[model samples]
Target: MDQISLALLSVFFLLVSIVWYSWIFKNWTKKLPPGPRGVPILGYLPFLSHNLHIQLTDLARKYGPIYKLWLGTKLCVVISSPSLIKEVVRDHDAVFANHDPTVAGLVATGGVDIVNSPYGPHWRNLRKVFVREMLSNKNLDDSGPLRRYEVRRAVRNLYGKIGTNVDVGELIFITEVNVVLCLIWGGALEGENRDKIGARFREKVAKFVELLGKPNLSDFFPILAKFDFQGIEKEMKGVLPSVDEILNSVISDRMKIMEDSGGEFSSANRRKDFVQILLDLMKQNDIVIGGTDTTATIVEWVMAELLQSPHAMQKAQQELTQVVGLNNIVEESHITKLHYLDAVIRETFRLHPPLPLLIPKMPSKSCTIGGYTVPEGSRVLLNVWTNYKDPQVWENPTEFKPERFLNDDDNGKWDYIGNNFHYLPFGSGRRVCPGIPLAERMVTYLVATLLHSFDWKVPEGVKLDMEEKFGIVMKKSTPLLAVPYQRLPSLDMYE
Candidate 1:
């Protein structure tokens, strides 16, 4: 009986050894992309940097455009070059259509929401509703007044502090919050109450965003996520309730108003405005954050870059003066006509895309990119930042040059839609950002309003700080502090 038991144990060990070696051998022969091999079990997790985009780009330089790295048990493939990017996002796009949500991501969005949802029938349905109801051109145009009102309010507020310094990012952020929040629900939040809650809500949302980028062991080794080794998931849960509480309160107040008003505010033909509403999808932290953060950050970057490059700033102002004139205020309609301003926007995007890595795409099956096998479920990060700054793609890439976008050689080439692989600020294929129309309009209009309304310059000895703080949303290390004075013809124009 002892000999029989010993024989069974030996057979089990032998089977395990063979399977493990076979798996290793298979991966070795699969033509996987080259990358640094880290310590056993932990893989390259220990070596990652806080500025994930810059760190990945540095690795790409050493390992070529396509490279792989292991973060714990997970495989991360970084795609940097344009040609290789096309392979994954266009050629084999279907295979990489899915998103591999991080442990923190799944918690914040609960495996739901359009941004983090797995690509499938359900996601497709959500996208359909999002595009149709929220982002369609008609919907955007109908809601233009709401956006314009917010911008005008911002302009007025800045006018009050004509000589005083203002935080460009914070002001734009608060304004955007109002636009998205008020547009989605309505006058549910009004007067002084809205102002107090809006400021507090921004802090809560910012806190949630800060947590998402924190290094989480659960993200790298998700199998043990339930153990909450790092407590990131637990912390994320703690954050969500606060965010949900604000959202629910706003929505609940709106619903009560509708009920008390005999559903007058819930009219079927109602425009999405400060007073009109209807939509049960009230857990809109994702929408509000996405809409506000990216747009506001870009505006801040645009202003920072312009401040650094006086020539560009003068040119933009010159064009604005010609297009909008001194007597008039910046209207959304004026945004399209401001050619130099458009180039400035593209330049800023090229230099500093809000989502530097874009939302990471995960493949459904093993696929080949640049002759290397990217195994199924690998976290594929499309390095838009690297592509944007590649000297091969841009002339003097690191230099802040808005004219590169306006060059006639690439006439009609540098568009927001990612058709020309080299310039993809908004990404490409099916999963491209659906909010481009709204985003482009908002950022352009807001920047145009600021530029057209005020001649901005950093205070003496401020050094025009453009240092970036890396996060899910790239923020100015120091929020832009510039003095604004009346550039418009009259104060009534602001009103």
Candidate 2:
């Protein structure tokens, strides 16, 4: 038995050596980063785990912060450290400005839209419309009333559910969905119709985001994409039509309203970017999905973290009570003055980055990062999750401590502009989230209102689950279910 086992072990080592040397020799001239070798047909594909983000971060431990792995035929590189991230997002921004979308992603966006558009004029135009028009300071400020209406509705609705368990994620999802629809097409759909549309959009978005993260054989083995062995593409394509129906209805309604009002309802007369956003269905679709889900997931997470850490929750509530006051409801105007609450939001972002790996970037050309040659079009995953939780970067990295950010505040050093590589919750670069203006006000105000108007309590002594389920957008695996009771001075304030 011993003799046969020894001989087989020797043979296995010999075979692995042959494969490893073959891979090295094939790309010897490029000087690629070192990585594990896999079977001939599926290179490191079978070995990939469900949570790709966590798996890649773990891989960084064995290999350096920046290393490469072959996913079937795709050469995927992962960057974990801040210095390497700085190189990719900052120094070589243009070279890696392009997005490397998955097959499901391509089907979802139709290869057009600001998030997944090719790095060129078309993308620039979309960004221009998005930034200079759709999300301008003036447009966002004017739209404050729209957002306020939806968020306050949620607060009042929760007030009605006093002492009863409520699903926080569902509550926030519906509110954000309605808020985005308001901005997308003001008063276009309302009453039972708006509620019906929101329900459909919520289902479609959950399916789409789930598909976006699923490992497609087509992505790893491009040749298999047409076949769609997993049917991921078909399912993704199926998801879009329902979304299009919703978008189409909104467009048709808005157009009818315009004609009825003698064309006074044009972008020029109102939001100023409706026409541009309407022209591209995918752009509007991305906005709806990205806008609703990211904000809701973040709000749920902040609540979960605060629930578990009573000290942080009490401190945040105390700050909110002092700043926002019991006589008035939480408002966007109160966001800046709630410094401790701001720290709590920053701390939550640090812990639960909305997009764990900010939309994978593909280099426009072969480039060098961390001194290793990253080939053109290779899927380069920026492991920002690792950077956020790195021991060297933060003290007690895994612990939930908001005070860490407040202790060393210096001239906007910890802002979300992605300037601070150590903490880019929304992301950073030429393609930094254009919706920042709206997201900041929405996320902060929602959390502030909930905390200020009512005190949150976890269901019946159950421990709050902080476990995360990773996708392109990371969310709490277990949805937060809690009760809320009035903390304000009067019920009239809610009205």
Candidate 3:
């Protein structure tokens, strides 16, 4: 070997050691919030979990409101308190509105959809279309019949399973899929028809979600992000084709529906599902990825909690029976009268928010949070699970008490949205779930109808397992097994 080559190698090694020690002992030690100690360069990546929501919530209890976590080369600061969450996600909303360009987001939104779009004119337009056509109140009202029809179909299925063990997760997943499909394609899946439009939509949506939140080394290290070292691109490559096929077929079908009617579908007198409006957008601004995942997650969590909390379930059922009697189907009109059911749904959202660390919020420029200086592009996470469960904000925070929401003084004040930030399941800000109203309707109607028409109980030997398995959303660790009995004969629920 040459003498100069050895000399240059020695110089490089010395500089690398100096930088590594500087990040740990000098630069990061004082600036970053308190967190577990870790080795050089790698940091705390090994200490993290696949279900980061649960992991972060535990850490927040130990470390306080703001805590630091390192993923590969970058430092991520998580905010769990409501005051900081409001200050960051609202007051400085625009500053932290940009996405972190993670592989999960890129794959989920097809890298161009509204949910993943960079903060700019394109994102603004996409949000407008989502709110105006896809998620507008007028459209929700127009699709009320479709929702009612789906709810009836679900009730029939539940009734048939009376006295027999059933996997409620599979039942609810299929039911929610049909609800989304009817809204997406204007139809439902019938028995033995495996290749139906609804089935196709579910298949595509499932593949997209399964791949979206999977970990990727590229996300943590930008220099390797484009290279796709962890085969994230391969997984996405397999998912995108199915997603495109489903959307494209729906696009074509909507064109036919319009032609047959000799006019464009009206929000007042139209199916007005997601796909129909998506086709009309001209540019196909964003994939409807969030629609399926977010909705499915909400449904799953709502059902899981209902199955676990029998008293809460019975209270909802009692209200549902009174509001929607036997022989009658639950309608949009019934949603308002089922107050207990609404409270149950709200409790589910509070305890198990779909996106634990809502789409990572990045600062547009350097800023100060909790007395610490954060640089531009530093990734920030709103640890919603922590905020929702904070004992200081909620009474008996750990208990699943739906009655806490019932007003005691008869003043009729619903404290769901108030000053203390007790609930932010849909988040709060310019980027709040645009699908909030639609989600609320589906959850309310489905819960009210299911509880109204059937009595659900866990199997003989099996206790309702409340352990959570985290995905992009928190889900039940084990699928719920319940025997749904026909509504008590005197209840006349299905009359």
Which candidate has the highest TM-score of all?
A: 2
Which one wins on lDDT? 2
Per-residue lDDT of candidate 1, residues 214-281 (tens digit): 77777776656888878888888988887787777766766676787687655642656422222534
> How much lDDT does each candidate structure score?
0.81, 0.84, 0.69
Model 2 gets an lDDT of 0.84
lDDT of 3 by residue, 348-401 (tens): 777777777777777888777888766676678888788767777678887777
TM-scores of all predicted structures = 0.91, 0.92, 0.86
Model 2, 1-495: lDDT tens digits are 699999987785576556646755776899798888777656798898867788888889999898988886688888988889999999999999999999998888878877889989989988887777767888788778788888887777787899999999988898889998877677555677777778778888999999998888888867558879899999998888898887777777676777887867755436433543555544357877888999999999999999889999999999987887778888899988988888899889989998988989999998999889998879998888988788887989999999887865464999888898888887788989988988888899889988998888898978778888988889988889988888988989777
Worst 10 residues of 2 by lDDT: 267-276
Lowest summed lDDT across 10 adjacent residues in model 3 is found at 410-419
Structure candidate 1, residue pairs in collision: 187-274
Q: Which stretches of candidate 2 lie over 4 Å from their true place?
A: 1-26, 266-276, 280-283
Quote the lDDT for 31 in model 2: 74
Q: Which 10 consecutive residues of model 1 have the lowest summed lDDT?
A: 273-282
